[model samples]
Target chain A: MQYGFFQVLRQVELAPEHFVIWGRLTPPPHQPILPGSFLHLKVDPPGDYRMLWRPYSFLDYQPDTHQAAIYYRVVGEGTGQLCQRREGELLPAIYPLGTPFTHEGVSRAIMVAGGVGVAPLLMLYDRMRHSSPQLRVEFLFGARSGRDLVPGLLEEFGVVARMASEDGTLGHRGYITDLLPEVLEQGEWQMVYACGPNPMLSALADLLPEGLPCQVSLELPMACAIGVCNGCNLPLRSDGGRYPRRLCVEGPVMDLREVDFAALV
Target chain B: MGGSSAAQTAEGFSLEVSLGPLRLSSPLIGASGCVAFGEEYRRLYENSRQAMEGSSIAQLGAIVTKAVSLKPRGGNPPPRVAETPAGLLNSIGLQNPGLDHFLAELAPRLSQLGTKVIVNLVGDTAQEFAELASILSQKTDFPAFELDLSCPNVEEGGRSFAMSLPSLREVISRVRQVTDRFLIAKLAPNVCDIGEFAQAAVEAGADALTVANTWIGMVVDVERRTSRIGRTTGGVSGPAIRPLTMALVHRVRQAVRVPILASGGAVRTQDVLEYLIVGASAVQIGTGLWIDPMCPLKINRGLREYLARHRMSLGELIGSFQAEVSRGG
Candidate 1:
């Protein structure tokens, strides 16, 4: 459950404000890093007493390289400190927490991401590449401007990418859902996976064609990525009505149908 | 040397104690109302198969259910929990599926756990407590019941049953009539002296005691100029309160002869050791489980290793320090 910090082997600034760091975890011999699981990073700065730990989902897990990547925005003090971590620094972490995305029975899929939500999708795209080469995948990434879109990474996965931004610097001048209907009409997709802002997810749930299986990854403030805290609870839709479900355990990725979006939003 | 080595040396002389009729494999039971009802982390349990192979609810001393009541509670509103120095402040308002649903839904699931399920029952009045206890006693699988007379957030005379001997005795006596099952009265730390309450419960036919629920606390939002928690007050827990909890446990142990299950502020194996040494028959890990779901298993492993290293068994260690106290060593 606890992992010793591997070195911050590389760091890249994807945008003017965004950054991604790759840490090679010293996985206690025989531990294999998976695609969608995350790691809780111990980013307590020396002599600076504030927050305890921050969790970031894994972007890429290159087991051969013993490297894992995490993409983050400079949101607060914790992220700011994490961004400042230099190469060769040991960032103690708890890895591969929570269930990974289930990619089965689907031939073609569409991934919808808003801002930093694209991190986990990148790993999923890589894992599915060889197994389903002919799988048609469309990635719709939304941001404020073209500069916000992560360059070269999506294309390297051989995914057809569409960009949407509020300022019109990207492919479309509106939200990601503005182009979803057109894309779905054109492609014969079986499933859709999305991770983004609450509004974006709400819009997708409202507008998406019914009967298409959709899974969503929800982000909640978590002290422990594990289920014990019961901090991150989302209302789940059952046959009768909604009930509080643990996001950390029941899922970080759940079938969109099981979520009571109305209650959550 | 680290505390683990010291713990190893001390574990050799633990003892086997009984909390009423329920016997334990080891006295280190997961704290009631801390860990959820069942195993919530299937993946982590599945991944660490070796560590979790034999130990779970089935192997543990006992598993206590979260506080249940006759009526369903919505609980408090958000900012329910906030991090303190080395502790956490929470005012969950005892949100639980009502007693009927609990028996129908949760009881069936819990029956599969293979461990003794000590139901932590809370109520507004003595009548309600007796009624619920009566209903619970009728169930064939119900093992024991803990009267949570110390939940701080309830508006109807908050923790009044715990502060006074008369009310505490009346509540325990009323419930004891309906069920011959083990009755443990959980106490609150906010009181002036917890030993008085422990003595009262023991006199009322209570089998054991769970020392201390969270100490009431509050935090302010500077800009909003209001309390952080919706209820304006919350219960504080975690490592920060270990010293206070240990003192309370020791005091209660001296006053009462019944077994005490030490809770509140337990985060590490050493903390567990400290409780056992100070006359606690068992220890429960609470806030630590929130930081790491696999923490209980880790603590269990660590405790076993500590005992093994010192060539001692857990039963030989309980109340071993009490002798030192009596002799003034």
Candidate 2:
């Protein structure tokens, strides 16, 4: 990980509530942006110095140009401040942090996303398609409404996502997990990669076929994005016999089997 | 921005200050629990060119490790932190790898950091505190111990130890008997009169006092209608607490003759200066490290610039507040 400034190249409104900021790293990222890795951007004004660091997943990255896009929803103050940043503004950030998803020994995998959780999966999908041409990747994205879905952004990457919305204004009326049973029946899946709200992830974990491996990107409230503060903890399964993992380092991405979903409640 | 009569060069600048018999190269220190055992901060500093360009962790005077206990602690449950206006509320519940692990794994690594390491000890009882000092004194050459009598998150002995004079004195005195090294009693900010605790600590043989720890505060999720933190309430830290903690430092300085190591929401050079002018010998950076791990270097640079502009050395600036001019109330 490296601490440096990223000059804002552009800010685009992907949807009504969702926004994406494309920034060019000054010193550039020391390490390549792995699938699950993220950037902790200081969103508070320069002089405020309140340490309002909010971690955002990379929506896309151009290694040659040293530019990347961070997709986020204006949920709270941190993201609320981030969305207002204009082009040419320099924002302080730490990049390529947290353990990346383990994509080894996977030929065919299903990518599940809930709302803004689609951010990291886009990066992962691009990676898999480029590295292994024969690999088959399916994208199942769910949101609160049709307007919240970013099929336009997905199309830019040459992906056509099977969308789901709770309001029935989009593809399935109920939830994305509802389609998993039929999606699993279509082919033999090697791995499941997911990122989303806790309730959705818990439901996905329950719906998964037994012995199927799943990698999930978890979110927790964090003070220091580095490991020292011990603020963001990813509780381990009760039977796992391990201490709680610090999300800043150990993961933002973890195996669904190892995590204790019940304890998270 | 302002012209200076005596602008000192980097070579001529001195960030050194003394905390009683112990001397520090710089008055800035990494507060306990914030920097962990120094390894993580060291790694971040050494790796980042931005951090290295200005200064390194070596520029800091010393670092206080996270609280060490006799046995391992599981710590608090999830949702352990919440953000406030200009601060953070955390209930880590003193999660540590126990004393044996600290000595074996952490202590050896600390010695290589090129900075003084002051062990922060917390215990359920006075005997536990003494035993921690006894074991650490026998095993490591660490120069000082900051008795953490005011960890607000813990339910049992930790929360109330610093509030009550008898327990605070007993812990400090027991640790004093075990080691002659510099002992700093870290008091709680949630107190009736901080001066009383400061006086008791010195009378019981503390060489210095860390003005205060984080004050108890809480945050709630309106949607969930539940506490944001795991334990419902946690220690509130950052710039929000600086004014209150600075007042405590001023009170403690007046109550005791020992040197005071001020720990609060010191994020900038001016914050450090405020503590020093208020009569603190040194300042500790806790949440500031979260803001910028390299803040010490920036503060160190700012200190030199300020001193040069004023044509005053660090020694002259310390305890220079003119409270005597104030009329009696």
Candidate 3:
């Protein structure tokens, strides 16, 4: 439940504001880090102002090396401080919390990401390849500009990457939602997994075809990253009503149909 | 401390605690609101088998459902909760499936649990509380009710009734007319003197008391220069609020004769013991269950081990450590 020595093994600057850091954990020998699950790190130089733990989803995992990476955006003081840390420094973490993405009985999958929301999707990509190579995967990445995209990461996984930027500097000029119509028409995606800004997710929810399976990863200010805090809750539409369901316990990855996007915001 | 004492008869392990007419199987009960209507964690109860199975109905010592209202409420805006130091802040805006829906949907689910569900009722007015209690009492499945007097009076422009004794007493008295089911009044931490409110609720026929709910707190988004929670202010719960909960529980226990169910910061067996020593009949694990799903099982096991080691039954320890207040020690 609690991990003490999961230090940052390597840090790669993906963009000006976004950075990818690989944390090499000394997990109890036989234990393996699964994709979609996250780690809660105790912020060093603890003070009254910044005492709570920070959570980051596992972006990629290498079981042979015992290293896991997280993609984080410098959004707050805690993340800004985390971004500044160099390699070899020790950071205490509580890991692999919550349920992971279900990879069984899937022949093809489509992954959608926006900004730092791409983190979990990348992990899913790797895990699917290793777990079931027959699983065909494609990724659609949306960012503000072409510079924000993580160059050939999707291509390395043999995934067809579709780039969309807000500005006309990349593939599609408008939102990721603009391309959804065309993507659905081209291929039969068995399952659709998306993680991005709320607006993009809402748009996708509306555009999604019926009977096709879809799941989304949401972001919330997490304290314990475990279920107790009740900090992360996403409203789910059930039987024509909405209820605030705990995201950490019930799900961090929920079926799209079950989620009430209108109730969430 | 004889190994085969005649006093330790064939009941296995039993402790009788009273909450008005209702006699609990043991002093250990789940806190209201923390555990859902008992049906929510049915899978967990099934998984743990019967060792961890507390009565879904009366298993909680008494069940406290999440805050309910007269009509269905949609609750607050997005980003309803955020993490705090040793705590969590939530602006759930009291999102409930409405009284009618609960009566129809949730009541059946709760009834199947085989435990008395203590509906944690909340409203903006005394009339509303009375109406809710009246409707709940009429239902065949409904067993007991706990008026959440601590809810911030949004209708009165955001003033909590639990902060004032007279206001809380009036609500309890109004609900008493409709329901003979045991009434437990839950208190709020946003008050100067909780003893005043506790005495008033007891006088107004409240059978028991839930020590406290979340305290008002806020987290700021420095970049946007705005609060992180959708509703700028929220109730703070978890380990950060445990010590304060203990103080209130201890004070209320001294002030009133009604049984007190200690909530707030109970995450471990030691914390539960601390509350019990201070005169709490049972302790509720709130935020602790969020961290470790098996916390209640762990705490229950630990308490059993503690009681066995002390060579004392739970009844012998209840309110046995009270300290009389004198001019000096």
Candidate 4:
């Protein structure tokens, strides 16, 4: 984990209750930043109201600018205060935290995201793009309704994009699960990655055909995202045996076959 | 009280202690459920300059990792934690990677750190507990196994194993047969008579005791009309639980001859000293680490200064409190 003090270079609202924060952090000597890693950041501590470390997924990073981007949804008071933080405000954050989704040696893959679960997928998509052109990728983005959806987010990734909204606000009117079978039918998917709330990921885990490798990113209230506090844990699927893995350490993303959907959510 | 000798005063006070079979370089071990298997905290310690300066992380005598079981356990559902006034209520359901993987991929890494690795184990039955201990006995590297009977997170065996005397004896006796390494029975503070349970653990062949685990606690969100923590209840640990746990540890020390490791509400050096004064051989830093990852070092600094000032080692401070009808009144 790379721990350092970073300055808030930029912050903006992406959608209702969702925002992106950009910070310039220098990795501690001998440590390298990896994709899919997270930042255990501290919200401003005001008086006796001590704050706990909040985990943010790595949205995207630019080595040239020495800045990393994080996407967060205002779930609580800590995040609510973060959205109001001004530019040049600084906070301490631990970088390259938790496990990253591995996208190695795959020629074809599809990603499914729900709401702000799109946080980590954006960086994973960038890596997939920089990889050999032989690798074909498809992006499927979904939300509760049109207002919750980011217009033209799929276009920036330059991949074959599809969309679905629960209220028929934008694309096909249904959950992302309804759109999956058709995507898997069009091409032989070597890998599948999903990130968002548990229900969305669980539904995707249910739909993905057997033998298809699916990795899901979990979102939970993590106090010490470095694994010390057992706040964020994911139960492994039926085949994954009985132990629950800590999301802060072992994963934020794990194979869908291993996540015990019924046990966790 | 004896006067401090000049020679004794000149020497650097040691934080060393012998908890029966285990000898620690410092009386500071990361509490179970708070410390991870390895790498997660170490990488954070190594990468942060502030956490590395002046004092080192090695001062952490050991780490008692989150509980592991014979088979993997899918912990309770989300909303696992609720922030209390100065404490945290958590029902993280003994979430672990199971025994086989811990032995194969994890235990080896624990030894790489310059501290003891005390693996915590739990089970639904005595046979399962024995199987877990048997597997770890062969590893040779892990110095101890903490039989966790105080967790309030699970649903199957809702009542704690240590809550009843017979069950505590039965589980400890069975697991004792499998491993010769130091066996520490981690009991609960919620028991009706903690002293009786302490004697029960000692009689069952526990070499040492962790006095104790988090107290069962709950918080309700009036506006939401739901319990703050998922699973409705959790074990509370933090500054809020400190005094109550100190009393428990003090009582357990008086009842049992075995060394005691204090688990709850250890946030600063003064808290560590207080536990030691009341007869805790060591103190486990729990939820405090979440507030500041460098808590151990900061506490170690506070402890060292206190030791140097009084020219007393940790041993001298342990069980220093006297009980009497009058203080020479």
DockQ of each two-chain model: 0.18, 0.61, 0.18, 0.30
True contacts kept of 1: 0.09
> What are the root-mean-square deviations of the candidates from the true structure over C-alphas?
6.0, 3.3, 7.2, 6.0
Task: After superposing candidate 2 on the true structure, give the runs of residues whose Cα lies further than 4 Å from its correct spot.
Answer: A238-242, B1-11, B50-52, B324-329
Chain A alone, model 1, TM-score?
A: 0.91
Candidate 3 local lDDT, residue B85: 73
Alpha-carbon TM-score of each model against the true structure? 0.75, 0.96, 0.71, 0.77
Clashing pairs in 4: A236-A260, A237-A258, A237-A259, A237-A260, A242-B72, A242-B73, A243-B72, A243-B73
Tell me the tens digit of each residue's lDDT in model 2 across B1-329.
12211223474768788875557888988999898888877767666765247445665788999999998777888888888888989999888889999988989989898678899998888999999999999999888999999989887644568989998889999999999888999999899999999999999999999988999999989999999987899999999999999999899878988888999999899999999999998999999877765678778888988988888988898888889787778
| Candidate 3 chain B: worst-modelled 10 consecutive residues by lDDT | B1-10
Candidate order, lDDT descending: 2, 4, 1, 3
RMSD of 4: 6.0
Of the two candidates 1 and 3, the one with more favorable lDDT, higher being better, is 1
Q: Write the per-residue lDDT of candidate 1 for residues B153-207, one digit (tens) a residue.
A: 8777645577777888999999998888889898988888888888989889889
**The 10-residue segment with the lowest total lDDT in model 2 chain B:** B1-10
Instruction: Report model 3's TM-score to 2 decimal places.
Output: 0.71
Off by over 4 Å in 3: A1-110, A119-138, A142-193, A199-215, A221-265, B1-16, B48-62, B114-116, B141-143, B153-155, B322-329
lDDT of 4 by residue, A192-262 (tens): 98887788887887788898998888877677787666677666655353344678878887887777777
lDDT of 1 by residue, A189-231 (tens): 8999888887788889887888888878877656656665555
